[model samples]
Target: MQKKPFTELGLSPELLKAVAKMGFEEASPIQSETIPQLLTGADVVGLSQTGSGKTAAFAIPAIERVDGNLRAPQVLILCPTRELAMQVAEEVAKLAFFKRGVRELPIYGGQSYDRQLRGLRDGAQIIIGTPGRVMDHLERKTLRLDQVGMIILDEADRMLDMGFRDDIETILGQAPAERQTVFFSATMPPAINQLVKKYTKEPVNVRIQAQEMTVPAIDQSYYEVDRRSKLEVLCRLIDLQDIKYGIIFCATKMMVDELSDHLKARGYSSDKLHGDISQSMRERVVAKFRKRGFEFLVATDVAARGLDVDDIEVVFNYDLPQDAEDYVHRIGRTGRAGRSGRAVTFVAGREIWKMQQIIRFTKGKVRRERVPSAEEVEQKRTSEFLENLRETLEKGEYKRQDTVIDQLLDQGYSATDIASALIHLLGGDKPAAQPIVEEQPRREYPNYQSREYPKYESRKSSPRETEARAPREHRESREPREAAARKEFHAPAERREKPSRSPRREPSAASHEEGMVRLVFNVGNAHQIEPGDFVGVIAGVTRLPKEVVGRIEILDRESLVDVSDECADQVLKKLNGIKFKGRRLNVNIAR
Candidate 1:
């Protein structure tokens, strides 16, 4: 969290004034490290996550590098998505506020071409654009980068992962041979390294404190559960919380079966899914789950990927995921459809490191919560019963039982005794495993960027506070979906959403072809992944000929790509870790 004042980072007085107006006095770690180097005409590969003030790290230097007199795309920035292009352009505008005629324009798909054409004709100096649209402009000669002195790739890894490798290289190839190229990304995978080696000139590598922002709606917390007591913790959470339905993700098929069996035996309506289940059985389980036949579903990540349900109130990470990305995938099942949700993760012994990786990658405040005690669960159950009883009484629905109550009253039982016995009878049998009792105080991370999840016992939202917060929270929930919609429909950033030119190829996944290996991609039509995407991304990243990339078939939740056996390993090695179309493609040879 250490920061250096912007004044010390060598910004011009006017630009510094603009920064002051922005109300950020100090540079975040990334800015502190990369600002001076970039200002001095050195290429930079800033290694940081989103919300780490990465925008300013490149934006400030870009503003400093722009020339007002020769305003013809002096600074070109390529972002992976239209939303990011807009965001970067906004930041650049803020930094260039004090300077005159330092025109900045954002050019991306789905907007009226007239606006972009006018902006280009006006001799805009800084051009921000997504790869596809930028490629379009370049092909039509509507934009030129011959005068560009500096080029920055925002979220470089993301762009390459989204299958923009060909367009990116083509655009970069058109730039002058003498230019500064920079990259900012959350990770440095192989494809990124290839780009760096090919384009940059002795770039300074700055990997500062990882920074990320998370949704305010999800209440993310982890428990220090013993391996033997994980099932107990799971049951305790179900008993103590108002869980409508939930998904519990484990690390293995065997664990899914074991945990599902345990929950069902405890009278919890639950089901399991894993690699071992047949396709028909899986479909049956999914259908029953959708109908609310089961309140809980246990599965491994592999089995859960194809699930198309939403409105899950809770997500239980019964075992810590192997990596940070998987952690995101596991917890993403909840907190959807504009509803607040909870994610409870169980951390055993050595898996704590994996948890740390997740925290660092997500920059999320995963509060360390104490395990619920037996007495606490019992108290929660009793309180819930009383509330339900009160609701039933207030609705006048208890009158139907008045005759039975009268019979009991005539049997010499006082009202208080009858009520207490009835409450006891309504309380079901206790869980098989006793809840873990830990005295560890809850840990909080006020420094990390996360929304506070209010505890049920102490949360107090007045009517006015509730009214005030509703709009803001509603906006918060819509932002990501808005960005996602832009990606899906190829809509422009900060503009009205409307469908137009298809984002990806319009056809489904292609059929199998002879004499080639078919590779399965984790993303499909739902994720805006398409057929031509595989051809371009695979060939461009692997440096293989386009002819080597064969038929591509896009499906609802996945896609298929065909490649010669000779080139399959190369494709997997370089492309596996990259994200395509904003989703991780776990590319593998289809069975």
Candidate 2:
């Protein structure tokens, strides 16, 4: 993706300033190609992915063509979902910051109709809405497309797939016949191409070719953890790996702030990057990151655009991106400059299906992995401390403190006891590691929702004191433990797990376990319900934690999931009639 500078795009000085304020230094390929054509009133069929900067491509031209003084709906943009509509509306507002009297309103289902009516009545110059809501407004005559001069359909393929063709056609039919129609889609299916032929007038096709996504040097992997345990798991990973320079990619600015703050409170060196920070502050934060002032720089996808840090050791997708292209872009930040980087994604319940989408899109191998245990982090730290101590002794630095040691030694403290006391005092300043909940027997599952690992907490000790320790024979064998500790992240498909001595067994297929009930859904592989779908859907619909949702078994045409007995009825009540992939869900207790 060769991004074009905005200066070369013929944008007016004011719009350029607005773009600058939006923090984009260059126009993406789609933006550069479509801006000129769109400005000249050419109907465009932009074929690009979600994160290819398509929003600005349509937004800038729409802002340029809107008649601010006239204050009529000169521009109409239709999106497939309320979330996308809101995002597009925000982008338009940002780009139109300098253009006076230009107002953009987002109207979508599940919002207050009275509020939308008020916005429409206020002479909004631009309207962004979903097809269904737009059709509703049109039927009520609350929204008139007669004054619309240009109409854009974003995510056209998605809209058509969501069964919005009739509503979309009706809305377009109501628009002025002479209006310029632009369609941007990730793929040009037959339905979309037919739409282009019938509705567009000799449209200029702007297709961004997919670049060679060569990330062989980066080892990509995913962790199936619960939403509540993400932070703990992230901390454990950072500690175990001792990641010094890394970027933690978040899905939203709020998540960035919360994560950064949480890391700091946990005594981790970290900071945040987002739009809310002043440019000067962002520069300072980036400068500190470059100087290794912090180990982690948490940021959102939009805020990290155009960031050119090459030596990043790792990239953690704190939240899975909605688009597969965005996922690639996020992980691509690392593994640059011929460096072998690590990319880890945290997939919670309901996001399991999304993770698969990314794997299919990238055509790259991704393997499931377990989170580092609390004991593992502690062992790493202790090993590092001893190594540093050895280096200090080799340098003869300990001699400089001999006088203090001599005094303590003379006061009845032996040499080994003195060293242990000093070590204890040094370790006391560090915060105790958080324990991950052990909600179930340890075993590997498709999406190992948090509470997967058993808890391990070290006992506290006084200075120079000792406790009963396990015998060497009974203790964990040092060979396997040391091998596990020394192992590095390998290419997803190339890594092999070290065998454990303990026996492992799969859970019962239909265990109406104590305090839980087995529930079945009329969706499975044929319906495209993969391993994570039942877990994701049940937790998503019921708004319950994934812990209460137990083992899931997906068959050909049906699936069985264990749910807490207390919430079984709630799940049954909430998910009985909901739709999944255009088919109504039918959930019931498994016989």
Query: In candidate 2, which residue ranges exceed 4 Å CA deviation?
Result: 211-214, 222-236, 244-341, 345-358, 367-379, 386-397, 400-402, 406-421, 424-591
Residue-wise C-alpha lDDT for candidate 2, range 1-591, written one tens digit per residue: 555778998888879977654444456678889998999999999997645668889989999998889867889999876646655775676677778778888886655666678788888889998777787788778998878999999889877877778887888788889989999998989999989998999999999875435345579999987654677788788878888889998765556766685676456789999877889998999888888888899987777878888689999998776456667788989888788888999876435655765676688888899888878888998998999999998888654777898899899999999989889767644344455644232222111112232232254432111101223322111111001101111111111222221234443446557888888888764543444445445544555655677766766567778889899899999989877634688988876
Cα lDDT for residue 276, candidate 1 = 66
TM-score of each: 0.40, 0.55
What is the C-alpha local distance difference test score of each model?
Answer: 0.69, 0.71
Please tell me which predicted candidate would have the highest TM-score against the true structure.
2
- lDDT of candidate 1 over 275-375, digit per residue (tens): 66899999999999988888999987778986877788889998765445556778878877777878998876434545665787777778999787878
After superposition of all CA atoms, the RMSD between model 2 and the true structure is 21.2
